[model samples]
Structure formats: structure tokens, C-alpha cells
Target: MLIGEVARRSGVSARMLRHYDTLGLVRPTGRTVGGYREYSPEDIRRIFHVEGLRSLGLSLSQIGRALDEAGFTPSTLVGDLIRKTEERLNREQELLERLRTVDAAEPSGWQDVLRIVELLHGLGSQSAARRLQAVLAPAEGVSVPAEMLAEAVLTESDPNVAGALRWALARAGGDGVASVASGMASEDVDVRRRVVLALAELPGDEATVVLTDALGDPDTTTRRHAALALGARGVTQAVPELVGTVLTGPNDVEAAELLGTLAQDAKWADRIMSALVYGLTAHAADSAVRMRLTQALAEMPGTTALDTLRQLSRDDDRAVALIASALVEKLEKRLDDELGQP
Candidate 1:
């Protein structure tokens, strides 16, 4: 076959075939009387082989090595191609995400587009200050899309920047809830923790629902954060975790305070008291836990909590007895004051 026929059959353009010949990638096996290049059957097979390697993302040099080098193996090169393809895919995915976020912003013009793009770059910047500024203050009149803020909050590592992003996400209202909620499905504990934190700031039933689901998160920290947020919103579902926090804690005091606030509701009061009493009984050997529980019990209203405090005042542990005794006195005084007793 001549170059024209070879090009017609193989789909390799004659110009490209000539280029391949120049590079010694696939030289035609013979020549006609007019000195035009002619390809033998074996030469046509080599052309297809080169095209096949090219389809796998092989550079011309790599293809040359693959076709001609005796020791060349597909294993190492294919592995490298896979890695490079994965990297390219990742980059493309990131770009697609960036474009989607920008489109979600619905920029009215090129200026708005540029400002939003700048704000996004700032949010992803390595400098914590830039990330903070991006959330706290964006370009004039450029509204940062809640979706962008949601994405940033999930990956933000700096404490200050994360807090700012959460605050901004909350102020963005329930608009960002779905985006933040989607992150809850992540197997990454840190990401889920951030998701709950962001959801906690977001108001409305959407965020509340996601937070309620987070109560059962496998990650302890994620659960605790979710519980605290739910408790603040007066979600009674947080009671068990709050009670658990009082039993064993890093933020026992906060948990105790929020539990007390929840106890203000007449219906939940007894339940809250019962959980606390159960905690006191379950952790009988853990005096420190008992002490924390004792303090928490004082936050409850009505005679029930007062009676519980009176009973604990005479407990075996001297420290428990002393703390409970002090709390009992305070509770009595408060109850008396409420009743207008002399």
C-alpha cells in the first residue's frame, strides 16, 4: 500500500505518517519508481501498534521506546500512565468543582465572575489570613456562595479560618445546609466533625435534621459536637449524650449547663433528672464522674432535684459528700427564694 492508501485504511493521516517516518517511528518498508513512500503489510501493522500505544497516553518518545526497545515492558509504563491519568482526572475534577461553585454563585458579569474567582482562590490559599479574609470579607458586592463556603469549611484546618467559615455558612442561612450535610457521609472523622460544626451554625429544620442524624456518628468527637449543637437548639435527643458527657468529659461543664437549660422544660425535667441519677448510679466507683453529675443535678428545678441533692449530701465519698452538701445548701436557698419564703 502507498501512503495515501495506508492513510485511508489506518485512519492515520498521510501528514502524520510522514512525520512518523521522519522520527523513524514507522518508516514505509519500500518505495515506488516515482520515489513515493510505500508500506508493506508488516509496516502497516507497526503503524497500528504505534497508534495503539499513543491511545494509552504514551508520548512519542515513550512510544518509540515501547516499540523499539528490547527491554521495554508495559508494566512499569502502564503503571506510570495510570498514575498520570489519575492525577489528570483529579485536576479535572477540581476544576469542574470550581466551575460549578462559580456557576452556583450566578455572577452577573465578568467583574462579578472575577471577584468570585478571586474569593475562591483566597479561600483555598495556604495562608490562613487569606482564608480568614475570604470568609470574613470578600470583594465588595460579591456574595460568596454558600456552597463555596460549605466546601471550604469541610477542608479548613486552621482554627480561626474554620470558625469564620462556619459563621459565614450560618449567616448564609439554610442555603448551605445540603452542601454541608453531604459531607456527613464522609468516612473521614475530621470532615464529618467539621460538617456537624457547620450544620450547627446553620439554622432551620434542614440543619437540625442533619444534626439529629449526627447524634449516632461513630466518631466520638463528631457525636459530641453534634450533641452540643442539638442541645443548644433544644433538641431533647441530645440528652443521652449530654448525660454521657457529664459522666465522662472534656466539656462536661458546657454539657451540664446545656442540660440544665433543657431541664427548664417541664416535660423533659424528670427524664433529665432520671438520666443524671442513672449516670450517678452507673459510675458509682468513678468519684470524679459522680462529682460532675452531682453538680449537674443541681441545675435541675423542682423538689425532685432538691431531694436528689439532699440524698447525695450524705454519700460515702467525703469529697462527694462535701460537694453535694454545698450544692444542697445553694439549692435550698434558691428554692426558698423562688417560693418567697423568709
Candidate 2:
């Protein structure tokens, strides 16, 4: 077959065929009287081989190596193609996410679009300071999309930056709640923790609802954080978790303090009293637990908590007795001071 016939049959353009010949990729096996190129059957087979390799994303040089190199194997090249394809897919997914986030912002114009892109870039920046600035960036003009803030806060590891991102998300109202809530179910514990922290800062019924649901998280720390945030929001559901944290070592002090805050209200007073007293029986033999319980009594107001403190003053553990007796003294004086107040 002549070069033209070869081009027609193989779908390879004549110019490309000539270039292939120049590169020694597929030189015709013969020439006519007019000195025009003519391809033999074997040459046509080589041309098909090159085309087949190119279909697998091989560069021209790679195709040349695959066809000519004695030791060349398709295994290594196929592996590399698979890796490259995966990388490309990941990049495309990230880009699509960014575009969706930008679209969700409802930009007024190209300028607004550009502003959001810049903020998103900053939020994802390698520099912690830049990420912080992105969350705190002056929103006097264009607002950063809530989803962008939500995603950033979920993955943020820096304490200071996470706080700022939370604040930003909160100011965005409930916009990021859905995104943050999704993070609550993430397989990654860190992601779940970060999302909960952000949810705590957010102001909305959505945050309250999510935190209340988080009370059952299998992760101890996750539930504790959720309970603390819920307690601050006046959700009585946090009562049990807060009380449990008192028995558990971690966050016991803060938990005790939060429980005391809950105790101040008459609505939760009896429940709080009963729960704390029950906590006593649950840890009656543990002197350290008794001491923590005594310390927590000082935070509760009114006669019931006062009476409980008096009984604990006589606890069998000497250290628990001493701590309880001191707390009683402090409470007696504090009660007297309160009575004197106008």
C-alpha cells in the first residue's frame, strides 16, 4: 500500500505519517518509480503498533521505546499510566469541588468570583497565618462562601486558625451547618472533632440539634466536647455526659464547672442534685473521685447542695473528708455573704 492508502486505512494523517517516517517510527518498506513512498504489509503492521501504544496515553518517545527497545515492557508503562490517571482524576475532583463552592456563593460578577477564589485559595494555603487570614479576611466586600469555610474548618489542624475559621462560620449564620454536620460522621476522628468544635461556635438551632445528636458518639472525647457545648446552650440533654465527665479524668474540672452552672437553674436543680448524689455512690470507694465530687459541690448554689457538702465533710477518706470540710467552710461563708447581699 502507498502512503496515501496507509493514511486512509489507519486514520493517520499523511503529514503525521511522513513525520513518523522522519522519526523512523514507521518508514515504508519500498518506493515506486516516481520515488513516492510505498508501505509494505509489515510496515503497515508497525504503524498499527505505534497507534495502539499512543491510544494508552503514551508519548511519541514512549511509543518509540515500546516498539524499538528490546527490553521495554508494557507493565511499567501501564502502571505509570494508571498512577497518572488517578492523579488527574484527583485534581479534577478538587477543581470541581472548588467550582461548586464558588457557585454556591452566588457571586454578583467576575470580581466576586475572583474574590471568592482568592479567599478559598488562602483558606487552603500551606501557611497557617494565611489560612487564618482567609477566614478573617475583610468580608466588607465579597463574603467567603460558607461551604468553603465549613470545609476549611473541618480539615484545619492549627488551634488558632481553627478558632478563627469557627468564628467565621458562625458569623455566616447556619450556612455551613450542613457541611459541618456531614463532617460529624467522617471516619476520621480528627475530622469529627474539628467539625464538632466548629459546630459549637456556630449560632443556630442546627448546631444545637447536631450537638445533641452527638451525645451518643462512640468516641469519648467527641461526646464530651459535644456535651460541654450543649450545656452552654442550656440543653438539659447534656446533663448525663457532663456528669460522666466528672467521673472520667479528662475534662472533669470543666465538666464539673458546667454541671454547677446547670445546677444554678431551678428547673435542672433537682435533676442535677440527684445525679451528683448518685455519682457519689458510683464512686463512693474512690477517694480521688470523692475529692473531685466535693470540689464540684462548691459550684452548686442553694440549700440542697449545701446539705450534700456537709454530709461529704464526714466522708471516710481522710483526704476526701479534709477537702469536703474545707469546701463546707467556704460554702458557709459564701452563703452568709449571699444573704447579706441586697
Residue by residue across 179-295, what tens digits does model 2's lDDT show? 889998788999988878888888789889999999999888889999999988888899999888887767788888888888888989888888888989988888888777777
Report the number of clashing residue pairs per model: 0, 0
Residue pairs in collision within model 1: none
Best by lDDT: 1
Number of clashing residue pairs, candidate 2: 0
| lDDT score at residue 277, model 2, on the 0-100 scale | 88
Full-model lDDT for every candidate: 0.89, 0.85
Best by TM-score: 1
Model 1 per-residue lDDT tens digits across residues 248-294: 89788889989999988989988999889888778888889888998
lDDT score, candidate 1, position 330: 83
TM-score of 1: 0.93
Error of 1 at 42 (Å): 1.6
**Worst lDDT 10-window in candidate 1:** 298-307
